[model samples]
Target: MKMKKKNKGGLLFLMSVVLGGFLGGFVGMFKAGAESNGIILDVKILIPWISAICLLIGFISILLTFNFLKKSRKFHSLYQEEMDDDLNEIYYVQMYRNLEFGTIAFNITTVAILLALFISVSEVVILNRSNLTLSLSFLGLVLIFNVQKYFYKTIAIVRQFDLAFFSTPKDVLEYINSYDEGERQANLEQSFRILFQLNQYVLPVLYIFLFIISFLTGEIQLLAFLLVGAIHIYINVMQLPMVKRYFK
Candidate 1:
């Protein structure tokens, strides 16, 4: 029995999960202590800093994802030449797809953060959980499990393809194209389109409404939500120009 080498993207995800879990746990402990002391968490005192941190993390992750996508695009462009040799196209393809999946997972995590911020600002406790840290830790664990499951499933599917049999560039191209075609392509396109539209239009309008309400009511908590929305809008705008290339 031999252990398989972990994919680099998978390793990065593992690191992120571990880091996120620890951070969440630490924050949870502080939150628990604050609650125990009968200290009401001041949104004005805390949310701005927390939101700033979240925005920084989100931006870094988005930048890394963008770089990975650019690299994958480059690889695809040169894949024909690379396939002419004995290079393992399967490995490259798996790596590319893994990065893509990682980006999607990160985006999902960012959205979750935004949702949490929204709920906190609006004082809507859907889960009746008073500890923000515990909630964050739970979210981290859930994301970790789901991301690992997806990566494993993707690897299994990639393993099913006999890349060694593809001796010609045409064969490699066909195989890659086939994988990107049909239902997968349609779903990917649809998802991207929806995301683009939501981020491009719906989110900005929603944020404007929230911002105006917050300003009128003098709610400091909404600052975090507004910041998160602004960062998300910037990210979406940056990625819009590349969407066609990404989905193509």
Candidate 2:
């Protein structure tokens, strides 16, 4: 089961990278073609498409949030039962380490893609007075915020589990007991829900704000932002099921 999960994660990572690359390349080609034809595209052309995609993302996030709530209830019940059973400390420690590694890998890939996009788009931005450069740069900053958040959270989890792994079994059990309490568990669930919920709302708002800036400034490189936004949404949404599975 663990191996299967690991393989599934690898596949997901591969698919995300491929999809991102394809979208980036497709936009680059379109821009090149447009320039060759002596026709400059307006950012306004992208507003409807971006808005539609954002709406779709918002709808999906709402559904996922509802599903997550149901899963959380099931998870809490399962967690309580597990706490009463003969728990495998080694299994949990390994799980945290795996999660940490996966997070690091994800962050690395995301940063790589962001850098590539910036490099590819910078030349076009510099040549044109459009706000595409500024919009993408701002989006990059938002992506950085998300990457840092995930990294910090995973690091904390890894550290906690690392300590648990080295401690005596009795100490590990004590720590688990403290962590698995009703209040602590509820807080954990709430925190997870809030983090995703914040991303769901905050990201669309930020993107819309950027869209306005791009539209007004006439520097609309909507394709890049759309691609990045899609990837971001995809990653976050994809994690919901994994989060549910983790608790299971």
Candidate 3:
């Protein structure tokens, strides 16, 4: 049974890698063809729309995040007051799942904002010298600052967890992993497993993205994609020995 499970898992991993690579190659080819055929988007028009959408999404995500945090804390307090109340504990877990989703949404928006800024600046520097890029760049910076403000507010709400604005990432991860055992711990582990799977599946696609951009832009230094791919594979390879030691 264990052997079968291992083989199944390996097969799934292989499938995911194959799928990711296929999609990545497809998109890269499409992008390259589009550029060659002069089917390009107008940056000045597209950027403002993207920025506005991100701003709206970011605001909604922040509000939902705060609401989830507040409900989770309330349930946590109730659970503490009546330590035997399983309902309170379940509610706490539910609220936290919502909070996690909200956090992911907010983080994705922030990344989008950063990407917008990078593109806007690159346009000004390389393609077109326009006031639109300058204005969009300023807007991106402001959105990023807003992201920081809400992010700090979130930390304040969860201050009981010993998280802070400037806390080292390792420290924050350690604190998170120190959650009370049982459902919360299981949920955290599940989240970690999902993230690991995503990394395995997405890293190849991301490398393809970088390679495509490099090819399009004539930037050979983007071979840093090789470095990224190496580190990702190395981490997975090293994990086998670590897992072996843990099992032993």
TM-score of each: 0.32, 0.28, 0.58
Question: Which candidate's lDDT is highest?
Answer: 3
Q: List the residue pairs that clash in candidate 3.
A: none
Runs in model 1 with CA error above 4 Å? 1-143, 146-151, 154-180, 212-217, 220-229, 232-248
Ranking by TM-score: 3, 1, 2
Position 47, candidate 1: lDDT: 45
Score candidate 2 by lDDT.
Answer: 0.53
For model 2, how many clashes?
Answer: 3
- How well does candidate 2 score on lDDT at residue 3? 100
Clash tally, candidates in order: 0, 3, 0
lDDT of 3 by residue, 1-248 (tens): 99999999999889978987887788778777978898763435565556556545545654565566556556545655665667866765665665566567667666665655666566567756554545655665675566556655554444355455567968877766666667467877897886686576567667766766665555654457778878787767867975899999
Give the worst 10-residue stretch by lDDT in candidate 2. Answer: 157-166
lDDT of each: 0.55, 0.53, 0.63
Task: Compute the lDDT of residue 71 as modeled in candidate 1.
Answer: 52
Of 1 and 3, which scores higher on TM-score?
3
**Candidate 3 local lDDT, residue 9:** 100
Which stretches in model 2 have alpha-carbon errors above 4 Å?
1-187, 235-248
lDDT of 2 by residue, 1-248 (tens): 99999999899789967975776576667667777898776654664344334333433433343333333334433444565443545445444445434444544545444543454355345544244434544454455555445444443443343333235867745545555466468657876887676676566556755655564445875885887588667867878886899998
